[model samples]
Target: MAEWWRGSVTYQVYPRSFQDSNGDGIGDLVGITARLPHLAALGVDAVWLSPIFKSPMADMGYDVSDYTDVDPLFGDLAAFDAMVAQAHALGLKVIIDQVISHSSDQHAFFRESRQSRDNPRADWYVWADANPDGSPPTNWLSVFGGSAWEWDARRRQYYLHNFLPSQPDFNFHNPAVQDWALEVLRFWLERGVDGFRLDTVNYYFHDDQLRSNGPMPTRDNRPPVNPYDLQDHVFSKSRPENTGWLERMRALTDEYPDRTMVGEVGDAAWRNVAIMAEYTQPGRLHMAYSFDMLGPEFTAGHFREKIEGFFAGAPDGWPMWAFSNHDVIRHASRWASHGAPDAVAKLASAMLLSFEGSVCLYQGEEAGQVETEVLFEELTDPPGIRFWPDYKGRDGCRTPMVWDASEHGGFSEVKPWLPVKAPQLARNVAAQDGVPGSVLEFYREMLAFRRMTPALQVGRTRFFDLPEPVLGFARGDGLACVFNLSARPVVLTATGALIDGAPCHAAHLDAGRLLLGANGFAFLRPDGGLGLSAG
Candidate 1:
């Protein structure tokens, strides 16, 4: 690729909920193809689809049975080809999600591997002998609840699973496993995919010794509902050998024209950004992102640290930033106390687009979509059900997209996989499609502004020393981006002429000061000799 992703915007489409054309209460490839116009009109540079491979729906398709074929639930290989063709026709790059770290227990490779100790594929997955007392070989814990090691009755041994028991971690130490992964990428490259989004990219390897993970330091009084967050996780993941496997993946992607890859680095907040930096070093992944911006922290220092942390760790590496995705609660709902729903949504868009890297926008975000309140009876996500009231799981964020104000929000004719409530459905596309001051329109305008501003796209970011709740930064040379992170108005003293900003009650310039309304923001170009400070 010619560095197209450096400043591009990608919109994620959760295929299971984007639209259901067949009315089977599930979305398909054909539905996505029909909705291509929505993405094209939204002004995003590319479209990223969640997993569509043959899966048993374990961990919501993160557990794949066939790596090279599309699930009939999504559509056949032909349907995938058609979707790619349509996306390309609309001038959009297509990036598909790839789960290479593990495979479903029902996968042919894993099935045969577990049948016998000496089978040809027995070494394909991480398998170990139990202790004298028949306990697990190691103390690793699954990202889901319970032990990471599962007992196999046939082989009388324990197999490691970083996720659910149905999802077995691949043995990256085995060279054959690496070769097969590359082949799988090659199969998709031949089919004309623009790139791949590697799921749980850093969880590809484990310590050879299979040593136990140590406890992580706690800094709070609140107890943790999930014990997975209580460990150092040094031996279980973030292995040094993952670099070699990433190189192999990069080399394979380099074989095709204009191909790219973005890996998801899931780790401790302290190390995830650094790991993402390492993964995107020379001869590896094109770009990498973490859960830093996708979490509950929304502060000036938090955003600055993450953006500057990636560059500080590896000056030459590239990082992709996102505020929401299929995982975590939507930012609007997560940070609800900061400001009004619409103001917070629009302000977030301006900040994300103004950041100095590639960006990804989740589905329904353009409509200012909030997380749905999924009841226990309607929960389908594994983690949500395992830890019921304490953690409702990701089903709230994975609900279907809202396209119109009509019943089901134009997502499907039959009852969809997830419920579409009135609060979120009220913000549908049909209502805000062409209306000015709407979140959808604001996003369209903000994206257009980012495209014309080279400084915002690929600029050196430097923060202004403003007080808390007021964020200020410089993109390139003259573009000054500022935002009020609180619900109350804030003022800053600056001797600069008001040059440019998105049309909104977000902010304004006065005699010698900048007055920002609640959740207000502005983009300014200053004259010579300009200084900014809190008023």
Candidate 2:
């Protein structure tokens, strides 16, 4: 039987920031095709492209207008087809982003829905009448900022948008809407795309009663980060109705052999992991990712708690883990003071590869790049614009990938869409290429190591009883793995020769315990088990 996607590695490529083949200062499909060899070299099984479909670029490419067609800014349908064909030829599966929860205001359905209150497509979106005082129907807040409902003068009512106002949430209650979204999926499936990365997978439904969400009781005694997180957000998103739609999506993808779907469930609470367990068991999504590791907290205890919580909450649901993405601060920048930036990057790669689920390696992370600092004048993200000084928004992480230290960091002939910060340039791929111990090389080695070790790739995990700042876990078939996440050395009692890195050597077990230096980890097995060797 063919194996499921449980232990796969997916490389996420943000199209606009990846590479520019046309010298237009924006990355496109052709650029992606040009870099296919790079992905193949990195040894990832799949590439998850972030929204190359037609869009107004309001929320970058999340506000898609034409789901079936490729954006002219990125490339045309033919270029997409060529890229898909090339990826398959190179043995790399291609996964595209599916933003079904909302559509750009420029979308035909949204335009028709907003034209009038009784248009044929009027109910295609979530529209509600204003309160007697003419306020929004409910106190929903947009993730970007302000109210989630935006007034439409033509309809004389409000339409809901969980994100920016330009992105109107689709009325999944409408069968027509569901059919249309499925058709969008079929379009790509027909084009030979491998799978989909569903954006905002849990926000597909709203409370039918339109009830207001109650405020969250203050627990930490700290002020709320943003008003959006202060409410329970129960009635607004993560409704029970979402599971049915997910099943429908699963059925659609099931028609294609070997196809997969990974949903982005954004709830910071553990509820998102529970929902992921519900949605991806056997027949729903192939896997799901959350924001648990995306935040700034980087202690060993925090990492252990997050992973253990997910495993406990969603015992059967497959998960996808990532250290950096387009939306938040890079891990190197977030956890810099605790460990050396480059060392942390390598350590993260090692730790993530050892997990029990699939992994997502974001672009530019292999180079040990930290988050770029974007000044207010250079900011493009709406969230940054809304919460300036308080929060710099996602533009820092969304900056163009630096391939070389040359002009524009070799990302573009003209200035890229986002400025390539000076600090990031020093960590470009060209600067680290062929360097024996560079972060990029470490990533390549770790990925190669994962592919060769079936236990690392697919084994069940059992965490060890380790102290704070020490994350110890054993993962493999009859193998015990342990890691020390702190900066100090610790002694461990083991009866086998230590094996680590390439050209494995026999470590002298001088005493009953072995000393692990700060930020150190060990993979030990019994003397009679599989002998230690690095791939």
Candidate 3:
């Protein structure tokens, strides 16, 4: 029988920052292969590797120039094949990042598309003529900044770029483009990859009318760091055409046994979850993740709302939860007000693992790594460079992973692509490896606990209605589990005896009086009676 992905844990590795094998200051396929044992020991069932495809590094591999080959910077195709074999040998499934929504301007299809109006691949990209006034035809804006449309002097037209201009959006409306993209996906499937993590999954198409988007409502106005956020984005992305293509993608994946696809839906609205539900029901993506929990929201109510709302929107569609990733501030820094970094990190790991769907653990998160402050001059992410002080961009979170306290934090023999700050060095893997109760140890124990407990691994969740700042939920295959995210002692009432608790945490079930300490959680079985109290 095929196993469900829900309730599984996936470790995400940003290839560029994971490790440097050849001491080139950049991580590569061999480096990732060398680290497979570490990931396997971390207890993750799967590893989601960021893009390592051939690219010009326009958007750091998000702009793919070739779909079937690895970039020389990362390694050759043989290296990728070796990594895949090694990962599978360690019982770890491999999911590679797939950026089908757009391709580098240097891609053969895009290059040919731009060369002649009558070429076979001419309509492979989203190209439109400029307005009579010599301006872009629409009001769409690029996520990196400025207009999403870039004028192409050669074609006497403007090309659409949902992200950086170098990443030109493909014309999903064109049948040939869809076939080409599907072929690229097939190439990976044939290479024995387990699945894909679709980047910007919703940006595959645009409104064909080229109509300007209307002004975003006042409440929606955040900052203007990315001009794309200044508009409603109705005509720019998340088009209805995307649904059909998603179905097609799903059908393609279904052809392979046990294969999966998890999409990264980059919208801020709660409705994004609903769209994910629509896309993944029966035959679309196997799962989808949003940016809801990645923000500064840390209260129990915030997490409760996000999870409950997601489940409500897509009861059947699995969700992939992550508190930190390559694109945002580390959770320790984002939720620093909660308490000590280690405590918050442990609490987050516990909470995320207890959720009803799949979970993603970003690299370095096991070390309780906080966001490193990168100055403007050292910034490598274009978004951060564009939105300087207000939004420091992602470079802060993209710092190289620290393996030891050695120079360069043992990430590279030479200086790394991104500097490993002193504070991060202190939290390197070697420093925390054997320490009792260290964040890394805590993660290992938690993951091991989840693996042992059927409820945590494959049970259904029933969220309990508890007081504010105290989020409570029950997960069991006939047993009950409860959690309190607050820092204050609270009374927890359950039906049965307390069966287990996390490391360094305790619970008691004497005469129906349950006492849960600050930031504590408990696992229990029903006592068959009601009216329990912690006091």
Candidate 4:
């Protein structure tokens, strides 16, 4: 089987935001199938659909209620099958999100488990009695906020919910639960889906002893916005026992041809790099990604450290790199101060794609999409609604994708699930289709450039000892890639014949000294001696 994901680019489609074909004001499977040609034009290797399984929309499909069926909000299983077939026909692989860490409280299994303690599925979920004083079993906190435990009056017990109270974590300690989770993967694989994007891969297991997690040290001295960040999270997630379950998942995928799995290690306290390494070793996940680059850290040193740290820790393990996704603020807006918006978007695409591993691009990233300012009443994300104003949740980044500059940006005939604002509408795909120097065009050009260059695709990376604001690295011995992470121009003396540069930014190699303008970048052939200039 071909390892198609290595060094490939996967585009993420948030189902509710892509397009609404039925005029239901929400995107669905049919809408996604109609957009496969757009992804093919973008030149991505695969398309990753966010959670579309049956749910009550509490966490916007992340809180799955059914493992085998598609939600009516996103269409039925037939729609999902049609979408997968179309994607495969276009030579683009289909990867769907598997949120098995927890399920909606309304799920039949959870409903049964929460019933009488002697029920057949009673132990399917993590359930425990409260402390003598009637407090939660531990200091564990939910990612959304508040205690991680929810009281169940029927069983007179508190169930563990790492997220919303409506979404309860599964008790992986039970061998039967692991078997059921593996069957969920088999169901999708038999459906013709190419791979799986494991959601919260590390949260599959927890300390069986219910040990309390102490406070973990923070690199930055900034105050915590969410109490969950204050605790160490050692007992809540990233447990060593999770690896055995990963082996089961990997074994199931290995049974299918050309199937792959990329796990999302949402570990902050334990430093995701280490967990990514542990989870992706042979016989486990094919690749793992973390939120290290999803935050507000935009520096050459920061990028170098993360890439270097992963390879140093797990030389044989593969990793996935992504700048922005559905769960966080868009990168274009987060790092806007680095340079012009369009320039930064183009530069970020070039830089992220040029890295040494597989890459994932969120919807509308090709058009340099920014976050929408959602009002309190319009907020749909649980976290944003819980912690309003200060942290306006993920709805900003999860706004509908702008396809055209129509009244609703062509996403829907009616208002979308999330409002489509003016600022986002201005950067629609129709506006940048063939425009010169446009962010969309830049993405197309950059993705094509990466496809034809073997060095940029699967080459080994070696960092240069260049000064700050100018991050330089060589991709194998064939290509040398450098970036200007600041808004000020910088020149570095280097010896290499330019292969691809200047077209990306106002940069040139003259007299062995490369002069790069603000937010500039270059790809050079170290062995060639040809000269290049910017006119």
Candidate 5:
């Protein structure tokens, strides 16, 4: 199909936890290359490998030390080339994570920028003078916890870091910085890659005035786990200048044949979709995703607003949606209270795949992988360690993939970097292979169905005004999907032909109505044009 990514399904592989071929308790490019067939078997159109770039591992590779080289831990450039070749051979497009919003303080660019102010690269980073009282230049808070500004005595200036202190934010306001960033993108594009999964894409720009973010009034009585949430974060990120950089990125991508860019728009739920809509408009990013659906809220209105709102704001824009990723808690575990873990996974999968945009399936989500429980001592994430019992960090979700019933779940010969627990191990691929009604097989079935269906892919969506617990919507003119979001069974009118998922599966179609079991869902082909009422 033309513009394969328009409605393509992407499988996100967390390389460090996917598979370890060298048996150093870490996954590498060779491991990912070997697993290309697994992704092919899952029927995904693309493979998005989370940062395999050279990094100091400050934020699990989000802190990049070198832009143009592969990390020795993941393997050399040869391994990356082999992985790309294998993915292309398997009919899967390749998307690499671009964490250029910030770089490791040890990076050559940041190192020189941190030197005395007269250096050539001094303005390459977001440096500023401290307040007269010796405080930070601004009250902008870091997502990791404290002030976003980290003071460097060498330059006698404060540097911006929306993330960790070791990962300094780049000065996108500088034309040289933007040019260097474009060259970095060119290096990867010349490597035969298909697209980019831009990490913290909105964090690429900050207010040039170094203004303070206003206080955000909390709607609840209880306080948040981190103080960063106390502020509105307007000045810290989501600056308007980001649009120019996005346009630059999109222009660079257009130079390459069939290349695309999907950015991660991390913002408040009330506005992230609008930001995503804005960024993905015609001359900017080809697609964008937000933390809206990745959060704990799994209501009908929430899903409708995110999917519909994005299109409502930018009709020409596209969205790449997901329920689980390396950064957040696995949706299977996060939404377990709604139904059985497997049921929730299947329901979420159907709902996510049936939407009117591209979809990303995180590693281990197919087998209904739940988040692992990492003890305080086993944690490697900085925020998790700093916050303790309150926030266990992302280590749980980033645990090594479980492939079998053997010890270590066939992920590695030696112990993995993150421990694989019983819950995760129990949902192994070996146990679910070819099993009828198994979560793994169901994923295969859903992916196969999604691939074969036209309306579900690159289609116009109109949501139904059905009541709570029943999320009814039509995709294109022919396909209609209904999902039961609750634990108890419910019945609704069947406005279309019963084609898939009934009786023994997610739901059942009776005489003229549909009876949806706990967390059940169904796909129907409307008899005529889907003229459903507005949601």
Candidate 6:
């Protein structure tokens, strides 16, 4: 039987900003449970909740203090159970963020591991002695700012952390650690989660030799805000040993029926595609996503290359594409320079859904939410505060979901964790619920369209040699997909019969000439293979 996740849409819910049922200025499982209907209406198959596990709130919930328990900030075990039950009732599968690569420094394993050299759990985390000059162990830089190694007085050694110092990387070389991590997965599986989103899946294992990484080759491209991007990072992450662990996880997931796992391969574009291919083989992750499509490039060539490149590298591997998540700027605001915000938003939704693989839609993205402009004092992301004006951090995209035009956008009756600004509030769910031509309505229509179209749902993609501002591809046997990847209008001579799923904007095929307005897209069932000649 085919898995339900193949070519399905999964919605990502950032718990803190989604909704607040208790008016505590924070969103809990109770709040998420109350909003299950929203996902059901959006026609998503699953809900991927960003880390709601026990944490001290450092680095948001990515720093897991207790893997087996829910954070008090979100809710308790009962709340999680109830939420899972409600999601199941609404026909939505629950997929949680499994931060297995690292854990909060406050975790019991880390605490015990850091206590003494010969303690029972001393080998649980990556710890190494300093060099002769009492300096750090390696030249590794943290993703946040400074050194990746933090000196621990208790163990008299420096420990490894890829992100915040408080979130230490585990020692995957230790077999005991692997056993414990698998146990954590089983714990959640028993609680009725349908799947897992493996966070930092590539960072699970490090080069056991602790070798230094080489410098990244210089290019004309824009560099990341942090110095961490300067290194090739071969020694720190994406080790070959990680595949063994993924196989172990797959074995555990296979214990239950209808389970799935999607890995997050964190690396540069060149290596990310290969890693995603490797991690998503039959015995490993069911699917994986890379940061390739998450960057600033918005063009027909860029999208075409990424989609083609992945299939070229791994024909059998599955890929999951997403434009916006908790990590980066929202697509509507990020690509606003190319087209109108609302138009770009709708176009992105249409293009993403039409892609060959599965898809993920971040919460509030259906309403064309743009990244908020956050100020210095109001900043909460570690990297944003560390880098100030240069990098404002992810807080812009992590603002509360606006349900209404009321105070705080009805996300909460009281003040929310993040401020509810005017721009975000103006695009509230209530305002666009039934409004035709609204981004929200467009998303609902497109999702339903994808569900109904067999070709769009599970079709193989074959690209056409269309020039700039125009991308043409054939999906399934007959459906020819074409798009104008610019704010300017374009027209081409092609042979096809127009097919309507979602509304086509300013597009029509008449007398063998296909006219596409600015930001226009169309689907056609041609009499034969699409033959094109642009005027």
TM-score of each: 0.98, 0.95, 0.95, 0.97, 0.97, 0.98
The superposed Cα distance between candidate 4 and the true structure at residue 50, in angstroms, equals 0.5
lDDT of 2 at 296: 76
lDDT of 1 at 323: 94
Q: Is candidate 2 or candidate 5 better by lDDT?
A: 5
53-157 per-residue lDDT for model 5 (tens digits): 899998989999998999999999999999999999889999999999899989988888887898899888899999999999999999999989999999898
Pairs of colliding residues, candidate 1? 506-520
Model 2 poorest 10 in a row by lDDT: 526-535
Q: In candidate 4, what residue range of length 10 has the lowest lDDT sum?
A: 526-535
Candidate 3 regions exceeding 4 Å error are: 220-224, 493-495, 501-511, 528-535
Least accurate stretch of 10 residues (summed lDDT) in model 1?
526-535
Residue 263, candidate 3: how far off, in angstroms?
Answer: 0.9
Model 4 C-alpha lDDT per residue in residues 1-535, reported as the tens digit of each score:
3898888899999999998999999999999999999999999999999999999999999999899999998899889888888898999999999999999999999999988899999999999999999998988999999999999999999999999999999999999999999899999999998899999999999999999999878779886788888888999998989999999999999999899999998887238999998888999999997678899999888889999989988889889999999989999999999999998998899899888889999999999999888899999899998888888999999999999999899999998889999999999999999999899999999999999887888899988876678777888777788888988888777676788442458677787878889899888877642223332
Count the clashes in each prediction. 1, 1, 6, 0, 0, 0
* Structure candidate 4, residue pairs in collision: none
Per-candidate Cα RMSD to the true structure, in Å, reads 1.3, 3.3, 2.0, 2.3, 2.2, 1.3
Full-model lDDT for every candidate = 0.90, 0.83, 0.83, 0.90, 0.88, 0.90
Candidate 1 global lDDT:
0.90
Question: Cα deviation in Å at residue 218, candidate 2?
Answer: 2.4
TM-score of 2: 0.95
Clashes in model 2: which pairs? 487-518
